[model samples]
Target chain A: MTPHDDTQQAQTRAAQEPIAISERELTVMTAHLEEAHQATLPVMHDAIADWDERLRSENDPAELAEMRARFGRPSRRGFLIGAGATLGGLVLAACSSSDGKKSSGPATTNTKAAAGGGLATDLKIAALAAALENTAVATYQAGINAATAGKLGTVPPAIVTFATTVQQQHKDHAAAWNAIITGAGKPAVTGVDTTVNDGVVQPAFAQVTDVAGLAKLALSLEDAAGATYLSVIPVVSDPGGVKTVATIQPVEMQHAAILNFVLGQYPVPNAFAKTDGARTLTDKIG
Target chain B: MTIDEQELAELTSRSRDVHNDAMRETREPLSEIVEVGREHRAHDEIDPLAGREFAKQRNLQLGKRVGLLGGVGIGAALLGLFDQPAFADKPSDIQMLQTSASIEVLAIAAYTAVLGLPFAGSLPAVVQTFVTTTKDQHMQHLQAFNAAATALGGKAQSMADPVLAKVVEAAKPGLTGPGPVLDLAIELENTAAETYVANTGALEDENAKKVTASIMGVEAQHVSVLLAVQALLSGGLVDQIALPPPNLSALPAAAGGVGFPNAFYKTDLARAADEGAVK
Candidate 1:
């Protein structure tokens, strides 16, 4: 860091004042800063400056465009990140800034950050979780609908049941999260324009034909969903919330087993452990 | 200054217009964007190892925002297939379907090659059935991938990586023997499962997630089948049915649901680990 670098850095920081810092940088900064709770804005501004420079210099124009489309929204990603940091009190002031536009000024303390703590009150995390669940539900329903529409074979009753049931569970989870957000008196998540477009879903549905393929697809989805929930569960504060997520989590494993069973892949001859095992701890902490 | 109710309302109205203008001018529909990926060349000398390294470089270039929206993992996966630009983007549902199909093709090649192993001659009836069924599923997976990709106007690659497919073909006879072939099969199955698992998080499209899940299920069965064959070879009790191993259960629920933990870990580190024997 030369004096020139420092001056450039300062100028860059000034320019990035209002833009949100990304999650990765927030993590790094969170580790670097002692969480004194002051001077947080500088770190975010610096991150934004760096992010803007990087995006400007990126070789892949398409990727950059995608980012602009997805994260350019001001509060969607940025506010969500702020909410996440504040709720956890982790000082990782991640600003996801979904709207692509850069905000002006140095980072300013906001009411959302002031409202941090407890599982129920954390609007950011709740909103994110709800959004994620809603997306999954929407995605799965779309997949099922597309699969049925393909008419390759009779959409097995079991396949229909699995997709519908799991989707319902996701819906319920989203509702529960919404309830929590409401109880906290925060606005529930307002969705983005990223609807479950049929163009995306129809092709995935085309990948399977028989009951086994359908079962297999369902099992894989549940596994992914289950893993996502598991990764977040430890970070979540509400025991009730944790339990709710956990209960939903195992259903994914069970779904995997059911698919395996249908495909004649189930139960170890020697072991009693339910197959379709969840990811191990070493998989994460390692 | 914070946008108060009135300012906020005014800005919101204005922002919509800006967004509309932007959309009209800059929004390339997904189909067009996907075409860019599809039309991109598969670099002749590219390997998964090189691909992974390329991703690391790209992510480094991407800066802090790398992990913000959906995170850097997708970037990493995209990098893994550096040779295949089509597979590199934050995989769409159609892309996922293609990848899953590619994996199935890989699995079929792997399983079919395994049959030529001397070990195949000595396998028990049940174990053989497992292998046979796994091969069948891979074929099914191939069909699924083709149908999905073709439907979406994307051509599914014959096999995602030619080197791995060639290796499977070349290694078939030698791998026919029990210890080496079984281990190789197990490793291949794990690798495929890991690939699907990794893709689960990397993809943003809902359809992609579903397709990735379908591939994962196939991989799990491959695991089950391989495990049964291994158990049978060892004269150990085989499972009543092949089942997906519980490797992902250990991850806490936040990162991924428990079932998908670190599915990307080994793939993420495979080259450094000298684990890319598939080549």
Candidate 2:
């Protein structure tokens, strides 16, 4: 007999000998079951416990209220346990419908929802990302022009070489983003968005012209660009686009770190990039 | 019209079958939800519960059969949960963090040994400064990883002395001058960067991934500076102007350089080596 036939026979045999569980023992059995569940899924237990702690400690009235509304009150362990039991019931129903025959196919389907927004939002985000890259290109160009014109007084030649290399990378990034946007049939942005240049870049440049100043400006630009990519990754509709952004973001952070080192700071300052609370892509482009 | 004993037994058996079936269907989705919950909890973010409502609805439909089965269904469900893939694997996050901490420990030991080398004192002041600063950073990283691991209920891992010995021994062949020493530093930084990148995706905790990536960014920067220093020491920048520039002349000819080496960072070298991917 085939393995499938064996499985069918075993399932049929099991179905005939149902355990007669008394209703009075249900609670005790459930407690045992919950214990087994926790032992089996300790990571999940820890996660749920962590969430519970957060919910209890949340101080903001509005945020606390929101959490309560979404997840119910913080002290709802009993309710959660009940929910788990209910879910088990549902699984049993499904199994019964299939006559207790488990499919030999792959167990889990991809659960990720389709990208968060529509194509238009994707285009907007892509354009904004492209704009940030363009600004980086332009900023680097401006720095290079200053160095060539001898405006960066006493800046080392090696520093100029470094800036030139970094500038080329920004150009590559800009081109890549433009390709992504144009490939989507969106009108490619023609030039660097001066909004970021005016608001952040120029002001930064006006404050410093030496190698130190240039490094500072470059660092800020890289930080902001990195932050923007990070902010957009979760919101972008295209999985490919999200992957692209994730790939690019590390490079930007790398640039920031190198610049930090150039300015006589620790290369790895923080354990995580300060991507939160930074300007968004829209904020930068506008 | 009274039900016979056979009929009652058959009814009970059918109810048990339904209960068992529902238990089977619920396991996979619940496990997924738990995984998502773990990730969100790590990040201190809200659980999205994107697919949770469907599971709930399915359970609600089976509510009557569930009532009949009493705690039997719960017992079966727990059994199913135990069989889930998420539970099947060992807790990888703590293990990964412990591994990372051990790597950091290795780094600290290697750097400390390098500093203690006879020729190290005569190296350029900038080189000395770089070595000390980097070593301090590794020490900090080691402490941080240990703290994180401990907080996660995992034991802190110390640097494997044998691994450190092996690394130092490997560098002995090139210890003749500062040039070789710098090259070795570059190699170590690249490996660290590649390891962090490769392992970042395997991390179950979002915060752990972020921490790893942040360290990776630093490692990449270290590679860049080390490459630049190597170029300077080699008399002049040869082939440094190429877009994405060539890897440091010290590195193998096939290796890519400091200028954003690849569109996507290559990962898994360190991990693969650790898992005996290397002969």
Candidate 3:
């Protein structure tokens, strides 16, 4: 059989099999989610505290009460429900039997396909993001290597240093995604998808021989990366996953803004960053 | 529970009166308010049981004076109450938009005031342009937010608040040169960014969360650019842009002075106070 046919058959076989997640795996996933949720609380609490102090200092008891009621404290209920649903969904997805027989209470056969669909979607998205990061790491490394070889003609030393730092950040982002996949009991994608590298990164790299060209390319890449993250966030089911995606998105925007300045463009270009050109690596590759 | 004609008429009258009062306070047209009220009435009719359930959910225990409008359905009265600027007992989506709009107004005013400074004239052309561009962006954001708030049957807040103005005035003495002015801009952008970030988590509507996230991204960009300018003016190389340390102990000497200075952007009050964005 051809490779495409073989892949399709494999997918069909995987879907037909009864999937299961161990209790230990569930515990590990829950722990990761709880840790992420805890990390976000302090940031939120700090904002609420500032508002409280401002209202208190104003001596407006009414407004102070209102502020207190508005953002009292971070509720763990939403996080717990969200995390539970995420784990439950994944578990249900995996435990789904192809025979269409109903499972016992609290785990229905009806939700099996839907939950599995969601988990699959999340995995695909994570893979796409990881692939993009791999491409970014490769791109930056290429630039860095060229600079070291004194072949990045007319590129400023500052831009080279910035590239080195950003390269490491992309590496961290890639590693984070791989960890998420591995933690979910999926095989981690280790390298940049060749199609993405060829279609997007390679074309951009081919056009940039000097500092200005590299800055322009970097701006485009960063903008696309930021836009993709923002777009994917709402679709991601896990709140912890949303937070992880959000944590990295702003840094990409930061990189883009700095590059814009390097290109003599306005740094803060818009009040709302546009996600006009957002595309997953899968989309590009496909 | 079909027809109570007298009670229904009384409810409609009370609704119009309360809505008119809101209109007078906000100086917005009454047609929009009436339209929103009609929409709520339709919703109540569609889900009559939900009206009583919603009322029970609120468990409003206020005095009789602030109670339901002459025995009107709690849902209908609550809808009317939502339009009122004074009734902030419960926070909702529109209130969040208004709060964000108010901050955007403050940003515009702060930028305008900074541009008026004598030192502003001596700054580079690019810096002046940056200030103007950022102020215009804030104005655009304010307009979008105000429109959203008004469309939701709520009053749009003023573009300037005396309270926020006083806060700005308190910081005026520190605006000695371009460096300090840029620092002030950085502080404002940081708060704005954090506020937007915090709201994204708080907002119930998914669209609102996404829109707020988009705004937060731009706000971070503003902070990044401002910090870069601040660094360049201080005779630091552009390569000095380093990531904020993950641990507080490893913080650089000029903590909060660099763009993206924190590994994770904090949305807490303590950080805002430390950053001097608030009192």
Candidate 4:
């Protein structure tokens, strides 16, 4: 580069430095997460209550039984059945079972190829994606709260900025998947994936006492989310669904890469993105 | 880290299938080529006329099986669309594989050159580790793509991307420190990541799409780390950039947000799929 160009490059590099974030910016960055929990959360609960009652009042036994027969699951499907089966066969699949049949040669060589096929599998995956997004959003929010309360002690400014920024992105991811769900005339998933919540997040997060601990906990979630997206893209039948998840996946990887740096690890740990951390598609949920 | 047993099994199965297919494809042709070579070597002078006759026969028989060699061999160079037997009717997957291998080749070359630089000697230990590990990864990626391509009846493109090789050459003279080299590395990585993201959707083969997407994730991670390092070097925190930070708390706040600027990785910087195809 010329002397003039070098001067410009220096200026560009300087511009990349983090500036002091305003309190309002941080709050906005967190999406007013406290207010979201205190105020909007109850509103969601109340609305869900009314929605649930309405469905129960109009509940049809024959349709519910048919939904059970078709879906054959209790946890994830009952909700979908209760929400109504206008989307009956169009939603849910034995994806976890079918996905198991395909060889990983890990993403292809579907020699046994058990996928029930099209839109149903995509919807199931969409539900799982939304749940995972909700899980991430909640995890970041908890991290922000713990830091703010001084429970983790002296949180770094850049990390706070990352939390606010990244959690909002997760919220956006959740909304994107929900939009696809509701667009199909089903209710949006408003909660985290319970399988992940109970088995992984809650158990691991309970041990987080310091910033390093919190960072590690968060990294696991980010890693799983990124890997899950990688596994889903090939099997998801719809072109739109594939595109939506593909776009969000790099962002998840970016999240993990940053976390790797905070924990004093090589940011890019593997040459190929691994599915070892990919969330298992349980016979029930998650 | 979580373990998905089924995913692991499938991964094993995938590796086995690729291995079996590669071995299966090459076993016969390799043997024929060897037999031909022995026949030729037995001749006292290996007559020029006889060599010419063998060449005509070899091209007719084993050329398609062995694939037109690339720069690393006889002609791993570009084959006409109709000439590729496995993917002749569908060359997009072959193009993606060839172009990816080309980029990996260029990455390996760039890092190898940087590692030998006078300034590179003084780079932070962690940075040195990053450079070496990333170079090795690119080598592995090159081998994987070439293996897949050769298995699919396409030539293994062991050549660096012609377009970006020139870009790296033009910038190498300006590399006063790790920062400048990091800039070049980051540029190549971001382009590869974005291109792979684009490739995932456009690739017709299911396995190819997943493989491309999987590698895209790693490339994106590389871009993230390099971006973070760029920020640190710019901030003059070279001493603080350790693998296990002497003090993670002392690392600047900017380190957190600097790594990931885009919520969605963009494809605007991606190279065209066939841009580096060995044509």
Candidate 5:
């Protein structure tokens, strides 16, 4: 045989040579791996437990409560008194006002009853939702800024087309949400550091400096917004408004799915679970 | 009162279906929200794929795509090693890294948010592992960011907010059921992974981008594990895999003008304000 033929034969023989790992042994190995995997989780619980301990021991309940009030439930307390008086007054004022331009303000007479005798908490949720909508609005604006800064002899047609489309969606959502907040007599959630922690917003844009990245960020933010709405919907007093928020959820899910697909990643299923690992679209492959 | 068997089973079924649906379909509903939401906007002006014009013009380029596009021969030659001097011109690298670190902190908060849920007390072993390790990964990511930043002459960050505190509160055992916690974890990890992968192209040092890519990989694994655990706790199959299936980028246009025509949108904030989705 020629040298090439001999080498080829040897390579083929090596490829077929698998004599070890009986079925029983393989099952044991798989079980062991799964066991290890299962066992590795408790360590996480312990850490969370430790965190809970620290929170319970060190955090002043009063101060925590206050913070929760300011950040989490600011409008809830005010809502009980605020809703009845404001909705009637605003609706009248809006009706009397000849300007077809309705109150884009948070107190816009659009009352969606809360899930459990809807109170101020719905307003807070709505405010946060509006805030999120605003953030999304800002993100698309930033995308335009990024594109503008990188002025081109001829910008990529795809980038131009997609960016504009996504931007319009964010704007519309923000406007729609703003109208909701205003009709309720709540202050419109203006764009002032809508990034969750009041951290810089532009850098988030900078980090994901590609069209796909921008799309993904939009999807992520939209998903978070959807979750916020879902979590809040059941608690709102107005079932109709709850229906509106609920309607919004599946749409946000679709946005995330589309963005995930664009980035060569997959969309997640659960809208409410914040920790589902389905968000890691890029990490699963090579 | 604890969630009953029927309730728990329902949660399990829903979570499984959501996971399954995501795996099966290229397009779900969220994109439509964004697409419908931004119908009036313009496009992002910069095209990342334009290679030499849009990207390399910035400064010393070291990302994988940069290497591939600048010159195949040159890129291939420098495949294994990164040139540090090339990164000297860009200060924004530090800013982006810090942004990533901040995101990591946000993740830690989200994963731990379950602590406040009423049912956190009796988390199954698998669910607990999924949550804790995911948090650990976030912590590790924070540390990695710090280490990488320090290596590059940037200081570690120290920003705190009520959001992180709230997340920790949410993570308290027996505070709530596992479903919500899993949901939050998924959202944060997806954001982080997408953010990192997107930035992979911008890093001037190919090595740094590689580091970012590796973190994205880990984050993705975290996603899969979390999905499985949620599925399992809700009584899903142990071997079930939850991924994005077809990535979000490739989805076709939504019917009746619902989803985005493309991913990026470029309208001004003022115009967006006019659109009424935000105030």
Candidate 6:
């Protein structure tokens, strides 16, 4: 393609899928990295008396509950609630509606009923993951859109390429989860988790006048995504489900590491990834 | 609770058939809700692959493949080593964990050698710091793998990967500088990453999968960082690898994408789960 054509193509691509790159994005998440790294390694298995005793006792509630608290129960406020806990910045929870009543905002309206009314725990995890991936896809698109609109100013070609690849990977991760959902005779989760969209992401996007601002949001986003994946692989029952999540977890982490580097921080901050801000099953899907 | 005996048997059956097929097919183990919580028999002497006759056959075969890839005499020598019952066509959680520990052993050894290079003390502070940190991380990974294995009633492997140890041993003399050293380090990281990736899909235990997958992410991160550092070194921006990189914009564009060349990390080049298992 000619230079003009290349520029037009780049512009079109950027408009379609924007990811603003900046140190601002990197800084938003580092505040939590120190605490996350310092988390005590949970050798939880050591707590069990024996395999048969542990397996036989549904009474064995402690480990499961301990783990579930790490990733479960999404609400419109939960996205930023977790991020606020981790990133140490920006409370974006939805509170007042246009008419001044306590309202759920536009987020709660898009909710689809849990597939078939209830899904298996593995399937629930899959659905929750699909929505998170969908939210990520939209998040990157918003960044690209902001950059293309000249709001972020002089978006670098390298940043565009980074956004493009990272966005596509999120798309793939969504598809993998959806495949499992659909294969199990459920509807594919086709919408972004509304809680993240309205409560956290939209507000964050409006504030991102520069690449760093947008990148900061994206970095926090990937940190949670990677952590959630780690949280579930141990308890997510299906081997296929574990494999699918396992493959994607590292990609999210790589994204975070690079962002950390861009932000002038240590790349791999934790010896092992932590679940401090991981998402569990969202109310969006059973 | 637990997986029913019939279902567990079916899973075992399915895994066996897959193992029989040249060990090329992916074997899905029993659902691990029961596996991870299952107690490791204290002092259990049971061999993980005792009954799977073809595991020995596959070992001989993998040894052949290694010989083909590395031009070594391993294939011909494998049978003599497995005359005992320790070998099998199927790798249980123990063998996989042992193999992982072995790789970690080799990695720590490689990094130690890198630190001991005659000029190592004078290497860039960032390179030296990275070498030291990564070695420590590998040591941690080794402990995690051995702990997981012993938890599952298996002996821990304390030796370096016999095959890759040879490769690293041969590559040692050329550890003369960052370029060659990083190249070997990347290979080891990729192999570790990819092997763990495959292990997540193959291992029978949920905790094993979780542990393997988490380590895989870090190993892949090592690859990403190493690749970025390699790019900086190649561009002759040696000073740029410094933590809190000297100047972000002054860095080359390759720095952006070099770290993650692929969108999805694959297991195509993954080392076999049994390649380094202690016999």
Ten-residue stretch with the least lDDT total in model 1 chain A: A102-111
Residue pairs in clash, model 3: A19-A94, A46-B268, A46-B269, A47-B267, A47-B268, A47-B269, A50-B269
How far out, in Å, is residue B235 in model 5?
Answer: 43
What are the lDDT scores of the predictions, listed in order?
0.40, 0.48, 0.52, 0.61, 0.40, 0.60
Tell how far residue B193 is off in model 2, in angstroms: 1.1
Candidate 3, residues B199-235, lDDT tens digits: the string is 5555444554555666777778888878656655564
lDDT of 6 at B272: 51
Choose 1 or 3, whichever is better by lDDT.
Answer: 3
Residue-by-residue lDDT tens digits, candidate 5, A91-208: 1111232332211111122222211123344444545555555556556556555555452222233234344445455555555555555544334555322233133344555576
lDDT by residue for model 2 over A1-286, one digit each (tens)?
4323433343333334332222223334334433432332332233224333333443356543432332221221111001221110000011212221112111100001211244444444555566667677667666665655568775443354355446656665665565654454334543444456666776788776676788888888888777666445445544445445555677787777567655654444443444432343223232
Q: State the lDDT of candidate 4 residue by residue for B209-253, as single tens digits.
A: 756777787788888788767766776667666655555444454
Candidate 1: list runs displaced more than 4 Å: A1-286, B1-99, B116-121, B228-232, B235-279
Task: Arrange candidates, best TM-score first.
Answer: 6, 4, 3, 2, 1, 5
Arrange candidates, best lDDT first.
4, 6, 3, 2, 1, 5
- Writing each residue's lDDT as its tens digit, candidate 1 over A97-132 gives 322121110111121232233331233445545555
> What CA RMSD would candidate 3 show?
21.2
The digit string of per-residue lDDT tens for model 5 on B78-151 reads 33223222222224444445556767776776666665455665665334434554565567567665555444
Top DockQ prediction, candidate number: 4
Look at candidate 6 and tell me the lDDT of residue B56: 55
The DockQ values of the predictions, listed in order, are: 0.02, 0.05, 0.11, 0.19, 0.04, 0.15
Which of the two candidates, 1 or 3, achieves a greater TM-score against the reference?
3
DockQ of candidate model 4: 0.19
Q: Compared with the true structure, what per-residue lDDT tens digits does model 3 show for residues A64-172? A: 3432332232222211001221110111122324332222211122222332434444555666677667667667766655554456664343454366557656766
Give each candidate's fraction of reference contacts reproduced: 0.02, 0.10, 0.23, 0.43, 0.08, 0.35
TM-score of 5: 0.31
Per-residue lDDT of A145 in model 5: 51
